[model samples]
Target: MDLSSKSGGGRTGYNPVLIILGTVVVLVGGYLISLLSPSLFPLAASAEAGPIDQLFRVMLFLGGVVFVLVEGLIILSIVRFRARKGEAGDGANFNGNVTLEVIWTAIPAVVVVFITLYSYQVWVDIQAPKDDELVIETEGLRFVWSFSYTDPLNRLAEADTQNFTDSVLHTYVGRPVRLKMETRDVNHAFWVPTMRIKQDLLAGRQTEVAFTPTEAGRYRIVCTELCGGGHGAMYSYIQVYATEQEWMERFIDVRVERILNPPTDPLTVGFNLLNENAYPCSGCHVLESVNWAGVTGPTLNGIGDTAARRASANGLGGAEEYIAQAIRHPNAYIVPGYNSGVMPQFGAEQDEPDAVDGAYYVYMSDDSLTAIVTYLCLQTATGESACGDEAAIRAAVEAQ
Candidate 1:
């Protein structure tokens, strides 16, 4: 039972070749795993995405190295240190190594500090304001997103109004964007997966997010937070144009021109208003004309004919009156299968006195409401308007 003779005369030796091979394996394995990052994420469409993705890859590499090292050691120990057939007692009895403990502790502490500094720098760089940043006013309602933009050049003082609003966030490559976001009914989140930017839209206060588009493509914008039953339908897009000239010519100039010379046709204006997501209808209804596929509310496939029947059944004056009432005061007559109070009240006034205390209220100008009604009234199988005329629609909306 001489222990020294069994332990090779008590001389402890290290395997240099094994150490070098293990280090090489750890480094190579980590690098190989990091190479899969591009496939793991959507296209890097923003300037911020580059650094963010790099940081992710760094962490991934470190994680892969640790994983390989730990699992490899575990497997090696299981095979190399298993008890022999005649072995019976405890394997090895020794005090813990303080040096080994210190090495493990110091390594993790250094890694943590490095990661903290690296992550903070990335955040600071991404959040820093850029020159000529386009400021967009973003509103996140229960199941929709609306983006508003003012003419950056201030060329149209005649149309000194709030400029224009659209459902899509439009910009050009290399242009920085700052989104000032607010929520109408509940908490929501504004997220652009390709841009790698997300910000919360609180109920009462406003929040903002910034990013610079580095690519020209349409990127999906989604509400990552579960705000309501229609959260899944809360999505839009960031339309990044290839050049500033293309953005101005295609989107900005077109929208501004529409504002400068307002369309006289109520149907065109109404279709434009709804198509641009002036209201949150797309999140709750299925209207094929505007490509709305919301499942929360009843479909509006043949709403013109449906409105005439509804008016007749409910003893309303006409289809125009019924449509007006449905838009302004939805709970007055609920569709048979749909629940009441789900749709927001589109009041004519900014602050309607008759609006329910806790209900969602959105302002709709008399003109816009009339035009919307007129447009919706044309959704019949016969391609004819169920409502009488423009004046009649306005009168009906006013009567509500």
Candidate 2:
């Protein structure tokens, strides 16, 4: 019953060195497996990044094969050269095998060369962008992304952001679309899971990310980086249309007209005209108490209260100066760096229609402008300050 006896196979055959080597190899192999997450995958950094995937995979496979070969040798040597009980004092010392040495060296060298060549080819394919392609301009700010589709007449595939998704940005299949990306504030990344393009946007410098969306449907565009307080809501959509014309007729042209002349009736525009064609604004900004993280526009809740964006006193005259300037030229005096285009010019101040009291901001004639300004000044006014904010009119009107 004594296992230490030679007949019972005492711990006589195992070589501690081989066991150590085998354990090391297995541990290395396991570490290799853990490096397979999306984060760990060799990202196609440039346009050439995609094709190198196969070569990258091959490199991984060769690494695994090498691990197996080395570990297998250690296991075999442990068992084959084990010490025998009463048969021999020790195993014979051995030198390296020239054949084994040459095989290990040569096989890997050949594999590495092939992988390099293959990867290079893939690199070439992706680095070169197509000649004629559309460009989407993206500007990233603290916690939001603004998409500018300059193509004007066309809209990208259209889809429902929350529940239903159907028509989306109509980008062509074969054509590569270059994204000119930058940031107004901190760093952000433009990511589209379907197209597999993720590019960083840095302030003061522009970055270019390109991809040919092979898909033909609506896809999501999300900010992959934690941008700001509301980073979780920083996302958008892209509609991938089969053809160019369909995108224009359906989404682009119609929206442009709307922005130029918003509908008069008490109807909320489909998507906020602010980002109707590009990023949806339902996440931020409030619309009739609906929460959308779109601080891109002034809140409608008390818009009438601040009659004049720039007012020394909340009198009637001061409020009038603010309202008129805000309507005619938004960029003249933006609210700090928050947003310049929050209020845009539909036409010249002369061209704006007269003001009217309704849900939408309507400008009738001179009479209405006076009426709206008066109405707004009264909305959140103290009984003492009315008749016109004389100080506001003096400074603003005189400056003009």
Candidate 3:
């Protein structure tokens, strides 16, 4: 073998079939991963998801084919056209194949046209709103979310529109809901993992998005965009119901009935109040088990059990004094990462802990505060506060 003609002649030993097969294996492996990546694929679905999925599949197949064809030809030519042991001057120096060139150009143009048409359809189907769609307005802040329901009618009514500033809804589930989102402070994202829809709530601008939930459970509303010091805590939830009637029954009808036939457990009233309307605390804190979760404030979820890491960290004997003080004087020991001095004093409000503080703390009655506290402490992990994880609870106080 001469090995003189590197361009055209006896095989250069490059194997196109082997190259094509190896590439096919890798492409198939990647395609399989795409199909199984639920965490990424389950984001949100509308009519768009189906079309987008189809478009992606088609594109993937086309891309794989193109790769095989191009690489296969290169490898085949390198080996098949190379000069033999001692071949001629310039083997096969003929003109290019016009037919092959036309085939490649025409195929890509046709493929692009089809892609453009299919993508347009998907874009239209997802962006267009149906006439019967439910409309909601969302207000986002540092660590909390607010939702307002627009009346079914085209007319805007304050009475019908739940004033997020005054009374934001707990966000009923079910129905095809459309949302208009905005932010009060910084940039935030309105994301519901289950529904697979999340949109930016840009300050001073209204952003629009929509979703139709299929389940009757509550899902977290997380902020995909970083907004403030308490970014991690910037989450809320939206409850989805099996049907519209079920939604009303759980969020509205039941509340009225409970008000008429009040429960003996004060926590009942407190939690119901937390869900009834958007209270100020609903935006800045999280107190699960009693439905008092606001993103800006530290989560009060499971506060009923009572021991907290703070007292434990300081080696304090008990957590009650600190818990009470934290509420009454939130500024006294502001959580390290939080912005200081924004929380109003709840001291005067706690005077009558037996009362419910459903309204804003500044003007809420003592009964409201007590009821709020009573409801909030249920998730304390230690029957007093969420801050009291037994291990950390012990460590917190002992460390000090």
Candidate 4:
């Protein structure tokens, strides 16, 4: 068949004007789509969020334009070169154009270079630590987050149990805050959607991320990394104060009192610790006294009596030993109906490497563990002698 004679116009039928017009249409349509995509982002509350959103919008526009151009060309070729009626032969035959290939390849290379430089700049700006930046040390465990605000003069205060000074992350509006984060067990990401900052918490090393909150509101702190069974509940709140005075009055002053006049009573100490959400117990147990309504684990309404009796039957020391064993080795004795691996190992390190889903890393001291047990042992149904006596319980706690 004579393909050139059939077309009559020969290769001139390929219109460069039409190709240019189509390219323009795809580019314009893609840009418009990108501009509209910023609506998908949540409210921006941090200073860094503005630039981050800007970069995102730009990338989205570029991506949309490319998508439209590629798909448009594919559809155009399909329709323009479709098989004609009664025509059963090759439409056209031409060798690949090296010039066109080179042009397309060079275009993406240039675009990639621009994107790399722009993204690197944004990264540098967001991570640059500013003067007077408040430092918050963050530790991510199985299903809980611990924040420690260290005193500048006494940097070693975190190791001092008597101080009990380290607490939640609290800041004032416009305050530059840097978080030195690490994971106690597995990998976890610290994310604040409104602030538009996210970083991973890695084990054995410290990672840092910084942001300046611009709004005065309570923001949700989420663990984007899937650590384990309680991953869904691994969240906390960041309270941004309106002013420095307000922040000092609310957070600083309270933390000061907690450190200087630390609670001495064992029961009060245990209650305060539990109520502080330091541990992930409330999410798995139901305790009316503490207003915990979680049903993930056995009810703690009368666990003291049950635990003490179980300890005796198991030939363990007493309630304290039973509770301690449970925290360190949750799967040692599973509840009748509940599963064995439901709870995390609160005070133990991960034995196997990279086995994060079922294991965790927690830095729990004997004193702290005993205090938590002391608190749990008092969860009596009728407020009777479920843990025997104060002297006996103390003896059990101090024995080992």
Candidate 5:
């Protein structure tokens, strides 16, 4: 057994200079290998994407360097310090070196601090509010994302509401937009891969993200959080118009018309609400009248007739009471096959001290809740019971 720095074959243990050279070569070679595959990432569509991509590349380079160094040392030890053919009982044996331990530990600590500070700066830059930035309110629900657009300039002052639309997010190239996001049921992450922005939507509080689109095209808005059963279908879109004129013509004008000259009839208003996702109902229910194909909840094609029967059978007041109760307390009477705790309680208020079934949550206003129930009551497929007259619908709304 050779315990000294020399072996039986008269060979030197190892060369320090050669080991350093090999490490440098492996690191460089690994970096080159990553560069050869140029199509690893998707297209960058926002101004913040450039800096984020660069940061990712730097982190990747550092990771590759570490990988090469660790694996390289293992392979080098096996090849250079292995036992000779039936010649050695043991090779050199020594305790660990304090200097090498300190070197390895200090290197990682410094690298981590450096990366954290660098990434923090990028985050601050991206989040800083810009002058004249457009603000959009984004809501993440069970299986869809809804965006509300507020007009800052009052271009369409004649419109009754400040928000023209509440479903789709609209933006223009080179325009800085800030999203005020919230979740309805659970935690959700609003993610735009091309824009390189992702933020969480928490219940009972607001989170935000800001970005300036650099490209003029449509990009997908994905919910990166694992929210629920229908999380996979939770997606939306952002339309980046090429010019200000195009954006105004496509979005502003249409929004103004929608608010200023809304449908006067209740039927149209109800139908539009279900179809255009004014309340995110289309994502949970299936209604053929407005082409709503969501299957998360029960079908509403003949809910009017069913409401009256369910009311009578359950010893409720009437059809109006049943519909209203269904909206306010969704879990009160779950359908035969449907599960409870899925539908959101719309009329539950913060001040309402009484909690039902150990559940308390934010709910919708009386007016909005009534309107939705009125619309649902008008949906009668059989037409045998005369689908609650307009007076009954109005009375039900006023009863709330």
Candidate 6:
């Protein structure tokens, strides 16, 4: 057969059947690829997640179409237009078709414009303020997250402090939440994968992020930044209640009641303080009593007994002195296996500035430190305090 005739008069003409077949293949392949998107991501737990996930699917579909089209053309050309066994001389050459070039160029430009507009609209919609939003203050430290909230109704006017902090973020379905976030020590990121919202917590500055929960469930809150040694453990949760009534009954009312009638016992107060994450201790210590499972610092399971032994071995005044010095001046006596400068200095003197000459510090009131020491002093096998009475503990801390 003549090569010219075989090449359709030296110009390959478009075949309607091949065009239709290719279109079908691209459409089917793209749809199939889009369907896998749901499995590729976490559950859409917030209203914003829906739109973001949809946008992802759209982009995936377009990408699949382009991938299939390009790969298909390459394969077809290799197999169908390969040099024949008896062929000789160079194959026919011709200039590209202007119409085909324009179509290809125009298609991508239109796709780019469409994607830009669509993504912008999605972002604006998700960011729009919603009515009756529950504002929560968020703080990120080296290895912990603390969320604070105030009573919206002012029901606990008699309480000395109305604001409370927790290790978890709580909200209800259909209720918007806005977080004013800050970092106490280093730069960190607040990310909720299920909600598809992430914001950075920069040092010396505050940032904000907003989202509305659509599902009533628990979702993990992770710090996506590499903050420090305990960065992997710097995670919490957002608990979405089914309704406002449920949230009030389960979380809000309980916290308010506790605040209004604060516990009198120092042991109980200290336990609550640590349990509620008021001091960020749980992220660095392990104490089965309070369910702290951190692995960064020394274990507190039998801290009472250990304190007694450590004080005697280190020639401290008593177990109380050992515990007090451990907190106020963590570098005073470092544990044998643990390195110094790991724990923040919990300075008790209020007159001291939080930071001086670029040296960072964290403050703890004498009352709180006393209570915490009182609690830790009782974590013995016998359930008895290894340290002295409240007066002795206060004196031990004051001596430092």
For candidate 6, the per-residue lDDT at 364 reads 79
Global lDDT of each model? 0.84, 0.52, 0.57, 0.75, 0.74, 0.83
Which digits, one per residue and each the tens of the lDDT, describe model 5 over residues 108-217?
99999999999999999999999879888887776567787766567566655566445556789988999998876689999999899999999889999999999988
Model 3: CA > 4 A from native: 1-40, 43-48, 55-121, 150-174, 255-268, 274-329, 335-370, 374-400
Compared with the true structure, model 1 gives a TM-score of: 0.85
Give the count of colliding residue pairs in each prediction.
0, 37, 49, 0, 1, 0
lDDT of each residue in 1-400, candidate 1, tens digit only? 1111223777655566767888899888888888875588988899999998999999999988898899888887787778999999988777898999999999999999999999999988888888988889998775678888887667567876856777788899998889889887689988888999988899789888999999999888989899755577788888899999999988888788888898989999999888867677876689999988778888998999999999999999999999999998887898998766567678878665433533457778888889999999999999989999888998999999
lDDT of 2 by residue, 1-400 (tens): 1112233444334456766776676656745643563346532322333544445555665666576767776777677666767776765567888986998799778877887788667645654578887776666654455555543433322422111111123455556877787775568888876665667888679988777766566667778887654566566667666666766666556655554555642113422333342223444444443333445555534544554444554342455576655544445555554554333242224333322211112222333333333433443434332326544433443333
lDDT of 3: 0.57
Find the 10 residues in a row with the least total lDDT in model 1.
1-10
Please provide, for model 4 over 267-359, each residue's C-alpha lDDT reduced to its tens digit, 9 standing for 90 to 100. 777786677655666666888877776676888888888898889899988877777777767777777887765576664342544233454
List the pairs of residues colliding in candidate 4.
none
Candidate 1 segments whose C-alpha is farther than 4 A from its true place: 1-14, 77-97, 184-186, 202-206, 313-315, 333-342, 351-358
Pick the winner on TM-score between candidates 1 and 3. 1
**Candidate 4 global lDDT:** 0.75
Task: For candidate 1, give the lDDT.
Answer: 0.84
What order do you get sorting by lDDT, best first? 1, 6, 4, 5, 3, 2
lDDT of each residue in 148-262, candidate 3, tens digit only = 6432332333233332232333344445678888776678887765565657888779988876565556567788997655566656667666667766566555544453455
Q: Any idea what lDDT model 2 has? A: 0.52
Residue-level error in angstroms, candidate 5, position 269:
1.5
Each model's TM-score, in the order given? 0.85, 0.47, 0.57, 0.77, 0.72, 0.82
Instruction: Please tell me which predicted candidate would have the highest lDDT against the true structure.
Output: 1
Q: Which residue segments of model 5 deviate by more than 4 Å?
A: 1-13, 16-21, 32-43, 75-92, 137-148, 153-167, 180-189, 200-207, 215-243, 283-324, 336-339, 348-386, 396-400
